[model samples]
Target chain A: MISFYPGPSQVYEKVPKWVKVAFDEGILGINHRSGRFEKMLAQVYQLLQEKLGVPADYTISFVSSATECWEIIAQSFVQESSFHLYNGAFGEKWCRTTKPLVAETAGYKFDFQEGLDLDQVIIPEDVEVICLTHNETSNGTQIRPSLVTALRENYPDTLIAVDATSSMAGVALNFDQADLWFASVQKCFGLPAGMGILICSPAAAARAEELQRRDHYNSWLKLRDNAIKLQTHLTPNVLDIYLLQQSMLERKPIDKVEEKVFTRYQQWSEFIPQLSGVDWLVKQEALRSRTVLALEGDPATLSALHQKAEVAGFTLGKGYGSWKKSTLRIANFPAMKRDAIDGLQTALLT
Target chain B: MISFYPGPSQVYEKVPKWVKVAFDEGILGINHRSGRFEKMLAQVYQLLQEKLGVPADYTISFVSSATECWEIIAQSFVQESSFHLYNGAFGEKWCRTTKPLVAETAGYKFDFQEGLDLDQVIIPEDVEVICLTHNETSNGTQIRPSLVTALRENYPDTLIAVDATSSMAGVALNFDQADLWFASVQKCFGLPAGMGILICSPAAAARAEELQRRDHYNSWLKLRDNAIKLQTHLTPNVLDIYLLQQSMLERKPIDKVEEKVFTRYQQWSEFIPQLSGVDWLVKQEALRSRTVLALEGDPATLSALHQKAEVAGFTLGKGYGSWKKSTLRIANFPAMKRDAIDGLQTALLT
Candidate 1:
């Protein structure tokens, strides 16, 4: 079966071979603190740097999921308040998750078709954190990178935390534009659902040092300390980390990957509209996410299409949040085979 | 090579085949919110209940690791402070991890040679949570079940939390003896690292409801809410959860498994003491953990033996924390083959 579901979408076709390599090399049997595990982590970090063009001064750490990063940000950096700019369900969830943790968490919900409007987002002077969902997986929308760059310039003293959950590996993100950027590997990295990557600028580490909340094991101070030693603060998903390194080894830089993603996304973006009873959800062309694409139909029409896709051995992503029954989502990830994408388009056409 | 390392230890021999099954069945591609995932999770919980004899009223949930349970306990239940009774590094680590998050945290360290003495452990009435390490992997000691039962009787009102990281699947634990019991799967359940099991009594759930700390993603209230729906609060380690279900299908009940563990442990208990320059770390026979066996020797002797074992194709567990140089830890987890243990014994004897 070919899966077009976003996040936990599909494993790279080569993953089985890499997993065998991990088994043969006893990767699953090593202690977390062993030198072999440490070297593997170092290599993974180096690969992320080489393949993604992450800044030399930035730090990369593995977490359980991108959702954990929300908790960490609220616990470690935001002493008083945070301001969230969002348009989709995921953005709202992040804001809701943060509200109870701090004195004040204010949210500005932009129009879904309009994307993030930096000019209209007003933040209080005391809000230490400004949260942005770099790509909103739920609604198939994204905050343009230039807008994030502008926001960083506008709020130089405030920490910029980007939920790049669906965009990290498939996009060429400017790490310097945000202090903390997090993503789950199940999305564009083309691995399974388990591990998350947290990229921190030097500024984000300093902020964590300033907060010094070491109560939780996943606290930034503890995570950063262990990550500097090329180890996780806890026993991590070693097999997934190994799979990530192997998967990344087969790829070129993010620019190249992003180019391929655009080509595939273009295939969907151009073809999805022509299908009977289906229309692109995000009316504005510039607002749609390259990785997670959504299409609209009536509830019955969408449900019928979903069933048809399943019977055809193509697993299409179910719509989320408010659009659950009225939309169908498709993931355009780097690991998705060209033939599989072609098959999906072919099935839909017939 | 045969691995005897405690955690991230050897997976069940059938794991590769099961992973192939998972890949073939498209387990890696399903959306986390899909019915398929919910059903998969429900089946896992059912398997755990049947195999472990966990009480009908108890709730079983999965977290990233056993360490994450420490944060959940501190953030959700503890209003004032917690008292920890521990003999090894892991117990003290739990205490230290809890300290910064609550009002006041206290610890009572027992002798490594004598396990937990529940008779002497006194908790202040105001203390909300009581932390215990059922098995101390660092020095290979365990608190007897009877002692935990007595402790529960002594502190009837306070919540009891057990860190059974290395013992849960290997021991026949009484679920009624504690409110919260947690363990990572790598040690006893014999799976690869990345997932943890948290078993909660009705009282533990009540305490979580009363505290209602929803600030973090891992807060007990949120986890319990999602758990009731046969789902996790976040995108979980689906592949690991599936692998765990497949692995547990071949196992018998906990009592039967524990009997085998005792038999295997007896083999090590009798043999390790007879080896040159090695003695049982836990002097009391009753105090030794059935799963993690530690041997004592001089630093040079232990180091030399460690190197020799490497050449002999035996991966022995390393000493940890304060005993880093003078002891060797051997995980006698359930998945270890009898022949592998015999091979280690033969190499040591020669």
Candidate 2:
């Protein structure tokens, strides 16, 4: 099948080969404490940094999924309050998960059609953490790094956490500006789901160490302690980590990979005007995600198109939650082949 | 190297081939919303129930890891009070993680060398949940089913939850007697880490549904609601699920698998007595685990043996936490070969 589903997108053709070797070599069975497993995980983290331009002092810990990252952040930090900015489903979901953290969390919600209005977002003086999504996969919106840099400059005491689950590999992230960044292996990484990579700055680590309640399995402090040994706090998705390592090895340097992905996204954006009965859902070009392209169409027509595409051996991602019928998301991750894109176009025309 | 690390035990010889086939067939990217993925997941659940003897009314959901299951259970069924029975590192860790349920959590510590004393255990009238580990991988002690059954009969109103992370497939479990049973794929299933299987009874389901503060992702109600459609409430470890499904297909009937594992354990039990300076850590044969066999020895001597075994191409599991230096854990799961066991014996003799 020509898979175009967002998040669990198509992986590199070589990934399966490496996974087979990983199992054959008994890498799957190696104890997480063994030198071999530790080396592998260290290499994975190294490659992740190389591919994403993460700072040298930053540490990456593998957890279950991006949703778990939200829990870990809430459980480890934000003892008092957090400022959550929500523009789409994932951000809203992140805010909902933080209900257990404090009596009341301050949140700013924006319409799907509107970009995050930084001026309208009120961060309380005592809010120690600011949570937002770098890319809103559900609505194909992107939050600019400049806004985050501004947030850090204005609210120097507040820690910035970004969920870049769908945009990390597709766009260039200014990791140095964000205290913490997390993403699932699916989405822009173009791999199957299961693992989440959490990139933590030294500041976040210090904050985690100070929090006495950070004792959960996926808690930042626990993960940070284990990560020092290049091991997860629990048995991680070993095979998935191996596949992600392979993908990172095959990925061009960050700038090149980002340029390639952004170029394809530009092609898709330009093509939207040529297509009849479909319009770009994200209003501002700067606010649109390079990896997930959201399109506005009639509910019945979109459903009909989805059925037709599947029958023609192409699979398209469904509009999520509130956008369930009115919008459709197309993934433009690097792993998607030109032929698959052609197939999608052909199916659409028919 | 010869690998014998417990609970991330060896994979079956056919796993690589099956994983390759799964990837080649595009099963890894199968639309989770489609009937194909649902059918595959349903088949997996059906096979798991048939092989493990889970009741027909029970429901199963795939999670990222068994550790994730702890969060799900604690966040879902645990409201008023939970009594945790701890005998090993994992059990203690679980209690620590669930400490936030403090308004409702009571921890009962036990000697790691002895089996649970049901009569001495105090279950407060307000304690609505009782959590225990079926097999303490850290110490190679197994909780007897008969003892658990008695506890259930006495506290009929309390929810009985078991973490069978290291024991499920290696031993026979009476699933009908437990409110919830969960295990990771890395253990007796002989697959890579990442996915956990959770089986829950209707009683547990009702309690979760009644939780007023149920958050979406970790909420058991959402998981069960999604499981009816053979889908995960959040993105799952798709490739690991495929790998686990393959492992389950290759698993022998539970009775037969248990017999083989038990026989191996008996051999180890008989053989360990012959070795100088080595003794069974659990003391009582009835309390010993069939899969993870913990051997007591001098701290220096055990450390030397670990180094020697690694040089001889065998990787042994270290007794977890406090027992790390004084004990050696031998895994006797189905994936281990007779040659590997014989090699371990030879190494010990040398």
| Per-model tally of clashing residue pairs | 0, 1
A120-155: candidate 1 lDDT, tens digit per residue: 777888888899999999989977788988998899
Give the lDDT of residue B345 in candidate 2. Answer: 82
Looking at model 1, the pairs that clash are none
Docking class of 2: medium
Residue lDDT tens for model 2, B1-350: 66788867777767778767876777766667767788888988888888888888998988887887888888888776778998888888787778865477788988866677888888898887899999889989888889789978988988999999998887899998889999988888888878888989989888877775466357788788799878887778777778767877878889999999988888887788777887888887888888998998998778877887877778888888888878899888888888888888888778
* lDDT for B49 (candidate 1): 86
Q: Which window of ten consecutive residues has the lowest lDDT sum in model 2 chain B?
A: B209-218
Chain A TM-score compared with the true chain A, each model in order: 0.98, 0.96
Q: What is residue B338's positional error in candidate 1, in angstroms?
A: 1.1
DockQ of predicted model 2: 0.58
Per-model fnat list: 0.75, 0.59
Question: Model 2 over residues A59-83: C-alpha lDDT tens digits?
Answer: 8888888888888888787687877
Candidate 2 displacement at residue B17 in angstroms: 1.8
Worst 10 residues of 1 chain B by lDDT: B114-123
Model 2 chain A lDDT-worst window of ten: A212-221
